[model samples]
Target chain A: MTSDLIAGTPAATGEGPQEMRSRSELTAKEVLREVGSVLRMSEKEASELTSSPVENDEEQTMIINMGPQHPSTHGVLRLMLELQGEKVLRCKPIIGYLHTGMEKQAEELSYMQGGTNVTRMDYVSPLNNELVFSLAVEKLLGIDGDIPERATWMRMLLSELNRMSSHLLFMATNGMDMGAVSMMIYGWREREEVLRFFQKVTGLRMNHNFIRPGGLAADLPAGWRDDVLTILEGLPPRLAEYDILMTNQPIWRERLQGVGVITAEEAVALGTSGPILRSTGVAWDLRRDLPYLKYKEVEFDVIVGSYGDSFDRYAIRLNEIRESMKIVYQILDKMPSGDYRIQDKKVTPPPRARIDESMEALIHHFKIFTEGFKVPEGEVYVGIESPRGEIGCYIVSDGSPKPYRLHMRAPSFVNIQALPHMMRDGLIADAVAVISSIDPVLGEVDR
Target chain B: MSDAVVDSPAPAEQLYGCVVTYSRGEKVIHASRGNYIATLKKAIDDSFTMCTDLTAVDFLIYASTNRQLPSDISGERFEIVLNLISLERRERLRLRVQIAEGEATLPTAFDLFPGTEAMEREVFDMFGIEFEGHPDPSRILMPEDWEGHPLRKDFSVGRIPVQFKGAPS
Candidate 1:
């Protein structure tokens, strides 16, 4: 009878996630690993924290699934929570529901067309994704140092603005997650203005794919500066309004201040980055510490938090919008005049006007679109600061037009690892706030 | 450019028995499976606390036109790349460990960097490169019952037949 039943199951035939085993079924070591205890503590220390004997523990603690559907999860992030009444005993994040096999798809797409695939991974900050992938490809092509001044500054400008827009979206969702319903409207209202600027510049609000390998797809549109200035000028008072609405509110402070706490040591060990890392009082911003592009040239403060909690994460992001604004102001002051992209004929296609007039330019454009430019046989990893965290792109080329392997080191994917640690011992109600604070984009996590 | 090659001890010539090589301005450390865990432990002690990214690449011969590896290290069917960042030193190190086709397993880095739990699971799911002693040791992205590793070059990208409404045979 057992054999007959086993024969019909998906487990015997290959279908379900096996990672969601109950905490009661897990071994002591497995529980430790699941809860992210090995992050800071030794095995003995980890065992001591989790191995405390409980009377009727299994009876008291019931296993429950929190989401793969909960709106507060950001997207399809299913967490299996072991709750001892109201307190969460253990939590395991069950992901991959949004898996579209993007890395595998990237292997099929040419380097020139790879941006479209990566851009969709972290949809909120698609520009950063494209920028990192482009930077890696450029490095492999041995033209890392040759990208024009205008292009680099333009990349910086767009990236910082994307950061602002992403943080604004976070403000909306984080507010909605915390039950401040109207703050959602206010946050989205501010963010749409940024996206409006994006649409004018990139022609699409999200997944623009405007930032390309050799340089951007095109130069900044006429009066683009004015549009950017408009956004830069308009955001402060609205952000100050957010300060009034959520930042200074007593209920907001009570809900987030001491909840979802993590330490600097644990945060680093779990490989959390961006606001999560900075929230732990570590001033480890990729833009400042490891300068990429013209980040070294820009002037902006890296916002950090003293306590690694939900409130700290929220405050860091809120302040980070201001910091990004600071960077944008400098970008405007120092926007240089030069070619928007490199003049290299091998990687960059000829100008559209040139194609209309010259036969050779038309052929070059055709070849680039169809076959794509070949990158040298080398591997390069380029990491940049996306709003969520350190988004890195690793590409391995085999003297081909397509990437042999294109891997995006998604911040959400790594940051999600720290969730169990953060949620451990916290109340079930606070879990929503914790997830909101992490600000994971499931697209990137699953991709 | 060749003449300007630094005569001084090549900054990080060797890191805990792993050969350090520079690839396009980034530092890479090549470690065999034997010393991979030990090197990682030492790397932690050396202040490379954060494991920024962990991924694997399947270099099946049919798809790979060329490979650029250091002279001494032989290329393999699968390579595990771990990008570690040292916050104190403000430096990044890339550790590449090559795993042979048949013996496709490496000890888990979970004991040191618990952050690698998900990444290890992803690698196992994608490339079928098992991280031995991994806590969960189950398929992550792909369903547990899924057979072939999707990221491997040999694995065919199969598609389901999309039957249009009112237009099926």
Candidate 2:
């Protein structure tokens, strides 16, 4: 009698509304086969199916691959997500598609040319990479104190600007990932202005290789002050527009708030840093804590988030741009006057004019360029507060022209570890939000 | 060499009996070869919660005879360098564990700081140093089918010559 009833009403087999609707939508042949299978099953099995339709349907978790080429991943970062219905059970971020072996290549390059290599690691924050590598080399050389005052201020200025540009990129990409299309346009517009200034100062849009072991590539170009001021003055209004567009928007709030929450304990355990670690309410900025470069002299607040949610991460990065601008303004006001590169003839090549007149200057230039400066046999780890986090360069110099082993403790690589913890038991959609909030660059991750 | 000597109290002094302290440039390094895992576990318990980096250096060619290592510590062909930081104390400590050329096994630090999981895998992939008890021990930055550890000093550059479309192969 029960089997006859099941055949008559195939969709009414004690399934939930969702399961029932899906069952009803199936083709006649599928329904017939399903009914036939149900009829052949025991009464106990039928009762179990009817009692817990949702559970029965979701018995098997679906494994879905997010990307190694997906646009939302920012670069070639593939995330294998195990999903049960709409929720993600586990996520594994598979990287190394963009592995350029930059660290291996750094061993072949001399210290003078090392800046150009490390700069390409975090392509967005090239200056920070160059700065950390140079600082490590300088520390090995035991000449950290001898770096000229003017050069220090210039590095500070350029780094802060680089931070602003990197954060701007985050704001734009984060907006696009969360479905705010206009932010893509607005974020790029402001970033383009910063890039224009970078071009004028460093002579490249990206991977400038301007910062060197001893000092900067050259002094700040003519009219650099006005160019910097123009960017500083131009950013606030656009930031206000961002606030209206994303910060106050209900949809944006709904998608981000209380989503991808990671506690301070989890963040630290996973070794996540930069904004991701800061978002967990840990107030542990390397700039403030370690006090590298001239960060000690400058006054800027470390923007920290309380809940450590995706929203907090977004808000922190947006507010950080304002803080970086503040630092840039301070650098501008206190711009020191002197040689941009160090005056040490062994480290720095002589001026173009000096090379023309003096045979000694020409010979010094040739030697420095060809043979390169040899660092003392030692290993030093220099960690700087990059826009991402603690971008450290661990260099082991064997008293050679080239580093024996150059290891970059890239923040992106560390921060990506937290993604599995963040995505665990969260909806598949939230996984996208969480990854976007992490703001990882695959170049650094794979390298 | 004198300037590299850290006057600060050595935190890992109690953990290992043979904890040799030396200065490498401006940084103070606490080095040990045997019982590497226990020393690292002690460091973690002593507020070195953050494992900033874990990398290995192959000193095949650059092993200078005038190396500044202490007399008690024997040098090896490969050395695993671990950088740890105590966030509360705001102090950084470096630990170097020397692994012999043929024997490349070191106990994992993943149980201490879960962050070292990927770093351990990277060390294994690049330098061929195996971390025992690692949750996922596999090639991180290289393909699984890769022949040799690329970062070893003995590993060749593995250069592939480039050819233009219309030019000779």
Count of clashing pairs, candidate 1:
2
Top-TM-score structure, candidate number: 1
| DockQ of each model vs. true complex | 0.43, 0.22
DockQ of 2: 0.22
Q: Chain B of candidate 1 versus the native chain B: what TM-score?
A: 0.84
Collision count for each candidate, in order: 2, 1
Lowest summed lDDT over 10 consecutive residues: which window, candidate 2 chain A?
Answer: A12-21
Q: Least lDDT summed over 10 consecutive residues: which range in candidate 1 chain A?
A: A1-10
- Could you tell me the TM-score of candidate 2? 0.87
Tens digit of per-residue lDDT, candidate 1, span A247-342: 999999999999999999898888899999999999999999999988888788999999999999999999999999999999999999999899
Clash pairs of candidate 1? Answer: A14-B145, A67-A78
**Quality of candidate 2's docking, in CAPRI categories?**
incorrect
Tell me each candidate's TM-score.
0.93, 0.87
